[model samples]
Target: MNVLRFAMMAAICIGGFFPSASSDALVGDKLYRNAHIWTGDKKAPRAEAIVVKGARIIALGSSEAMQAHVGKNTQIINLAGAFVVPGFVDNHVHFLVAGSDLTSVNLQSATTPEGFKNQVAEHVREMSANQWILGGNWDHELWGGSLPDKTWIDDVTPDNPVAVRRLDGHMVLANSYALSLANITRDTVAPEGGVIVKDDRGEPTGILKDNAIELLMKVMPVPSAEEMDKALAAASRAALSNGITQVHDMGYDEVGGLTWNNLEAYRRARRNNALKLRVYSFMPLTEWPRVATYIEDNGRGDDWLRWGGLKGYIDGSLGSGTAWFHQPYKNAPDNSGFAVIGSTKLSNMIEGADAAGLHVAIHAIGDRANDNLLDIFESVSKKNGVKDRRFRIEHAQHLSSSAITRFAVLGVIPSMQPYHAIDDGRWAENSIGADRIKRTYPFRSLLDAGASLTFGSDWFVAPLSPLEGIYAAVTRRTIDNKNPDGWVPEQRITVEEALRAYTSANAYAGFMEKGTGTLEIGKLADFTVLSENILTIEPVNIPNVKVLRTVVGGLDQYIADEGPVDLGTVE
Candidate 1:
């Protein structure tokens, strides 16, 4: 039967009609009314009310038309003119790590050497001597672009072993104590895909980039089950507060370890019925065999928690001067950056994962990395027969003009983070030069070319707020306010476009479009209510808009205020 017919019948079965004398008609558990709702559905794009039953939308229409679904048990909530839209879906995030970062040191905005040291010093006082101090995500650019050395925090953290990473997650700064614990010295050889910085005296400066960061992981403490659970809860609350009901968790992995512990934490939450949000988890690409075996035995999980996707890295990030590029960096002259994984190995892994029927998403930041990944994906598709392989390139940040059209032609999704565009805009021009920077984060160009674009926050590296992401995508404004007219104004997209990227497009990216992503009968009742109409407001004001409520699976997961008293039923 057609969708319309199915919806109409479901609506009648819900409460509009009673076919049996013995069984009472089903009624909406909750009715949200008197609001402007953007359904994210092209066929029926607007609504004034929604009736939710159990975990799905029972009916949606004008507030007057929805009164029929109300019964004595129905709790009615008056939105009072708030704007509601499909719940925001973050396409990429390091969920467990982001949760840890929430309670860790606050160094992302430490602008001065003194402040950075003081922050670390203050944090150390709260912990024991042997414990490792992690999760700083500091940005040296805030203090004029000089990389942090161990010396800056070694004195303050004499007792604690400190190992904090740069905001990009590509570089790490270890204190003298941490370096000693890891036995890393000037004599320590940097791996082929990593780097270790040294001073003129040839002493280790405690800065490790790319694969070299693994050296310290050997001595680091693995989080206990309790800690992981706490982190998961914190991360869920943060996401819900930001109107994110679903997140595509880009599972963490490195040379030494995988994210099995993190995945288990999610399972623990699901079992306990404590998972307040939806999760689509991805394992490391190198572990494709394990993923395939698990899928064959257990199958991909339900909507609340699912897996069978693999995430791999092609190169490092731009801020670390490690993003692989075809041309040398303008400022660094001779440095074009290196790949984190060899092309041959990366291609083999992706091909193997695709053949195993597992979803594949490779992280590609620089122009060279993106183009090379696209080539590999194209080749892999031809080698393996036709299937519903939704190959994705995460963080397709920088792209050549030629690579933009290839995304549409190849049916490859460019899963990106718009916040990065504005955050990097402040200094991106200096890194790649004016000529190449023009095409950076070509959101408008990609959409115009017919590529399915999805947006995310990248979490710990960036804010988890989709509202701020929308503002950045629509205004193209730099955080420093240096670009009031927008850093790359021509690349700016509409608020609706940005909203779609955060909503329906993201759901489609995760292969959850049919169940969630939009407000329609029989679909999951997942959405967010805002204080203002972002679609009708100024693009610059988008960031200021507040998330008043977040509903997941027909349940109110977050309420900005104490919440209104239910009016019993809509009579």
Candidate 2:
């Protein structure tokens, strides 16, 4: 018997925990040869060919070796020296929101105040007056760092109520109409972990930060089931096109967390064959009791649509000046940042979730927040007795040296977004000064300390492109080109390391490593055919490495028409 068949039989005899890859069970549907394949498996990291049978990778080796499984009816595709790697597993993303952002007003490129207004004005003309204008990921930092008030957009959106989020999703700029609809006034108090930016004479400035934005959440009408389904469909297409095969979606929305509603929408999409990429949805940790009940009724779900961990915010975000920090901000002296949930309650919530057998993935940005969350995770693990609970710290940015080392000691995953390093590297020193900046997104440090690291785009906040993320990690080049030598260049990693973080590492974090992640025998047949070899290219040119083709589950999900390269079903 062949090794693949022997392995399958052994697995079945051992009660079949790992997926079986029996030769007689499924023959080669397609064979891709003549490729520089990065397997992402350290044991056998490189391969020249791969055979796909059904949705699983049957074998990977030299071109001559893979041919042994090629049946008469099998289709063969010659890669012609192109590069192939495992499909990108983005560790953090907001799925439905990313889809909506695609069709929403394009404010990401709005360079000037006039440009921002013009984009919104143009978009307003196309929408009905009753429809709420949403999703303009505007960044004030690009346009001189002056936060625009309602007055800036009040004139253009007179008929429509607008509540647009900032690029970070930590704050919202509400028009006067939206404010009135929410009944928000100058006297309205901001929530504990939120902020209502005010103007002269203590009047509201239309900018709501962190939990303050939640105050106005319920004012807008909830999207109908049909609308939810449409958004999810758009998300799937967007993900597949970007070469993202799976996403550990930081699922749920601000308004009531929208757990069951969004879960149903994902289910509806799956039932209708509209799901293009795998999604592991996470619920808000604040809804612990409710989410536990939901999990009890639904279990952890399947491969296509998974119920991941409980997600909670340790604090707000850096851009919003609410990320819980140990020291006061260099820019804002009075601010040391505040926690979303108090330390005691935060500990309780995490412990309860951990005890319930749900993995915890908390959003911890600042040093203090990361430390606090780590301490809680340690306590919970000791009390519960560890048994492969892949607890995660989302963003895990801006850490102290102790906190960085603790991540390795506790076996906690530091779920990081590299694009933030380059983007924030442009101006983060101004907020926390040069001293504290050394510990910011310490990728190299984490890896050296034996800690597992995963990469994500934090989509909508950052573009959902693993190529762009890899470029950021490999180059550490600031977006502004201010740091040609790279911002904190010591933290920069190699292309192979970055690829693993984007694929295998992220897969391990999502508990999908057994079935997917590496392009190994018995793994899911999901891979991205690249236009150029990212590993050999100049570090700066990595972003130009286009995703020529994205294949998922033994089927082509995206094929670029711009190129004349013929990737085909050769019989």
Candidate 3:
């Protein structure tokens, strides 16, 4: 009898003996030939062909060897000398927000006062006076050190009250109308973990930082379910087009009305078959009660949409000077930074979440915050008797040498954003001083200690391009080439290492190592084709490498052609 027939007979017997065996049937599908494949499985080198049967890869090798899995009715696709690797997995992202932001007011390119005003004016003109104008990712660094004050936007947004967030999401700029609606005044006391930037007269200047944002955001209207559905659809398409097959989405809060309930919207998209990428949704720490109930009642979803983890912030971000540091900031000597959750509270939360089988991904940027979180992780693991709970330190940006070692020992994954290094490296030293700069985004040190490092682009805070992230990690140089030898040169990683972090490590972080990450047999078919081989390019050129095509689930979803599109507009 043939091996297939023999296996089927054995399956039938096993099914007779054990009723569950009926569910474990293998069905063959098709094959893909004449392609150069990078299987990410370190044991295997590049292969000339691969075979797939029913959603999963069945075999991989030379074309002649893999042909055994194909039948007369099987379909085949020729890669035409294109490179195929595992689909890019983004370890951390706010996918729904990214999609909505794409359609929101774009302020990333506002280089001058005039440019910023013009963009806001255009957005205001399009919106009714009652409607809010949201989502402008303005960065003062890009604007030649000129921070936008209320006066700059007050004139442009006369009718519509605007609340535009800074690129980092830790700070916000509100126009006069919005400020009055929230009843914020110069006398308003800065909340414990927040700051209300005031002018010389101690009057509110329309800029709210960190926890202070709550003072105003509490009053803004919430988006409807339909609006959220639209945002999610847009986000899903964007993810697929960029070759992002999976995302570990850190969800927003319920009280703010931007809750993880958006999963309902995701469900609707999935039912309509509009969801093209897999999303591992995480509940915000504040919504742990709801998450616990949801877990008990519904359990996790299938691969496309699953509730996998819980996300919380220990501290704010460096850009806004809210990161909880051990020492006071170099620019602001009296301020040592603030913590969103106090150390004691954070420890208890981690412990509770760990006990519930929910993985914890915490955002800790400053040295003190990172140290405190490491201590919390250690304490929780020790008490819980660690199994396979893959705890993550989201944006472990700044760390002490001792804290770096704890990550590996405790089996914590550093869910890092590489682009932050390239962007922040430009001004990080100025904020913390040269003495403490060595420990910033210590990618090499973390990897050397055997701690799994995953790469991501904290989208909206930075661009969500894995290619750009790979370039940032490999080169370790700022965009303007300020550090010719590369900033923190010793911490720089190789192109291969960066690629692994972007793919396999990220997949492992999301508990999807078995089904994806590696381009091996039995894995999902997802990969990106680049204009040039990233492996062969010089590190500096990695950022400029263009994406030629993005494939997902054995389907070509995005292809960049050389020809222009017909927009039906006259010259």
Going through the candidates in order, what is the number of backbone clashes in each? 0, 0, 0
Better model by TM-score, 1 or 2? 1
Cα TM-score per model: 0.96, 0.94, 0.91
C-alpha lDDT (0 to 100) for residue 138 of candidate 3: 87
Our tally of clashes for model 1 stands at 0
Lowest-scoring 10 consecutive residues by lDDT in candidate 2? 12-21
Ranking by TM-score: 1, 2, 3
> Residue by residue across 328-377, what tens digits does model 3's lDDT show?
99988998888987788888888887888887899899999999898889
Model 1: how far is 418 from its true place, Å? Answer: 0.6
lDDT of 1: 0.88
lDDT of 2 by residue, 1-571 (tens): 4864666434322322233224444447888888888888776678887778888887677776666666667788887788999999999998877776678776888878898888889999999986788888888888878897888899999989888888888888899999999888999999888899989878898999888888888787877888788788888787887888999888646532466677788888888887788888888887778878877887777778888478888888888788889999999999999897788888888888888878789999999999998999999899888688989999999999899899989999999999999999988999999988999989999999999999999987898899999999988999999999889999988888999999999999998999888987677998998888898989899888777778889888887775325555545
The deviation in Å at residue 110 for candidate 1 is 1.0
Alpha-carbon lDDT, every model: 0.88, 0.84, 0.77
- Model 3 worst lDDT window (10 residues): 12-21
- Pairs in clash, predicted candidate 1: none
Candidate 3 clash figure, as a count: 0
